[model samples]
Target: MAVGDPTVRTTPAVNETGEGTSTILQTRDLRKEFGGLTATDDVDLAVEESELRCLIGPNGAGKSTFLNLITGRLEPTAGSIYYDRFDITGLPSHERVDRGISMKFQVPSLYEEFTVRQNLRIPLQRAVESDVFEARTRELLDQFDLLTEIDEPATSLSHGQQQRLEIAMAMGLEPKLMLLDEPVAGLSVEETAEIADILQTIQAKEGVAFIVIEHDIDFVEMIADRVTVLDQGGIFTEGTIEEVTSNPDVKRIYLGEDD
Candidate 1:
């Protein structure tokens, strides 16, 4: 798909602000196994309210598996998952969504034949009061910079635009914490920066926490407030991007560096 599509996502300012230092999501010894193959290995993760945390590692490091476990796609083999005060260990995905958790996978999820506005309306229709549906739909359309494409079919949009649309749709559900997998994977560098900017804006204004599972080191560095590195089915280290990049173990063992 072409990257030149001009449907940039989001304009700044919804005039929203919030304050909190509580833990919104946490997992205690979270583990998932496929028979003898352990994918998520005793991961103890905590994402503070409104924090932007990124998980990055080489392929097969269990980043996706960890996401699945937290989102209720896979029941963990052992340990527990907690969201706020809820012990949501085995709750279904929709139940988690009702508790203000949502996820956007690497691929865009949109109604390909629907107009951009229609795509936004679908999720908003389900989440918002019926009297406010149209108003909220227009608000999201403007927020994602999709006002110009309000009438255009989603299938005709560039891949980058569709990614934005999908994310915007995810936001329509009013999630407190959103899990995004490789959100900028297919975009050009400029497009990457734009999406990162939009996310940062959302984080600051809406107090939304995001656990971004990504392998693009540069992209992770650009957007992550804090980072955790996973390796061979477990957390190898946790720190700021600078700290992780400079660690000799991370550099030599995973980052292909030789001393």
Candidate 2:
């Protein structure tokens, strides 16, 4: 049996449906610290295959730290991270991507000078034959609804459009699990809703799984299949959109209550 394998023994915690489900990413006693302060305190998060889990918290809630630990941006002071069936706690960022993991940061990270199509070609062209690369580029442009702006420089696109392009590039990696940090951070309501719609369509058609970190409640309600609430460095609670929203403690904490 592998160390900390769920297959060997059942976990005391059950899924949202109160049934055991296949998990794609899991952490045991995941922790990170800075000097005397603990950033992630014994966080145990489980994400099932194709599950859309959202992480939410006020500023300084450790949401970013938790993602960093999983993506290998930072090493944990103590814990183990499991992806699929392998132990990936010690893997680096690129290795994690090679293992079918990808991430989109809050800020847009693209080649602004390059056209949207060119940005995609930079990655796909390196892996596929010329014909395949061209086909993939066209497919991505259509899939992302960017055919009209295919040759336009990325900087010319609107904020929302830029966000979509970044996601499209990440999808080019054909990742199994995608981590997103505040994907709609600085967008208008319409823009945020558009992104949510695109995500739902992709999830239904392609079965892409995501672990998203966000502060926007409206955006969370639209895309979250399950919500994980973090407070002070640990997981406060997790549940469906309605469940988390209605929880008295969640309401109080989200409002910065003292009692």
Candidate 3:
């Protein structure tokens, strides 16, 4: 499809003040380079409040580079990142988390030696008041459907269960924006569906925006409010799942089809 197809959505139009009123994250000319190679080109993107946006691309297309830049794992060589209307391009990763930005890497980050209850308490202890910490931990456990295994060691649970525990811990922070890198990377179909349901429910009830980098097309269709395709280190196209999936250019570039 043509780049400007009316049915296909592109970047949001910046207001006179240079930010969308509803946008939770915005990047201007975001770029990253290492040695002689440019991993991310000048890419301008915006994610709105409570939006479930998916980022997909072929390997070496710069999806990881862009995510690292947003989460402050890697500082951009050029451009600025704005979160909640403030410039956060130079902030450190931990500061970003403290400021309501959280990430769940592909590998689950759980305390393997701790019980489910103990793992959940790690983040809640730091964020919730002691008076309500126990109650809040229970709430998160129930939400993630881990109440039954609350006392089980992390290493004893199935892989999917461990993934759930990590997510529950991240939610303890009450983040405004959640960055998930291949959240359903390794799991049975049933487990993947459960993750999709949990994400949708949380977004609906909590109003947290999500920027997910995933290769699972089915899961992307299941959770994405919008889809962004990255190619050659920049945005190739973006639109609703249907519009993006049907675009000939996207299919050719993303699926490696040749004329």
Winning candidate number (TM-score): 3
RMSD of each: 11.8, 4.4, 7.1
Task: After the best TM-score superposition of candidate 2, give how far the Cα of residue 95 lies from its true spot, in angstroms.
Answer: 1.1
Give candidate 1 regions above 4 Å deviation: 1-21
Q: Which residue ranges in model 2 land beyond 4 Å of their true spot? A: 1-21, 125-130, 256-259
TM-score of each: 0.89, 0.89, 0.90
- Residue 6 C-alpha lDDT in model 3: 75
Writing each residue's lDDT as its tens digit, candidate 3 over 1-259 gives 8854678653332331134288888888999989989889999898889999999999988998898898899999999888885688899998898889888887678888999999888878767788998788888889888989989899999988888888888898889999888888888899999999999999999999999999999999999999999998999999999999988898898866655
lDDT of 2 by residue, 73-135 (tens): 999999888777777888888899887888888767899989998998876753467878778
- Which candidate gets the maximum lDDT versus the true structure? 3
* Residue-level error in angstroms, candidate 2, position 67: 1.0
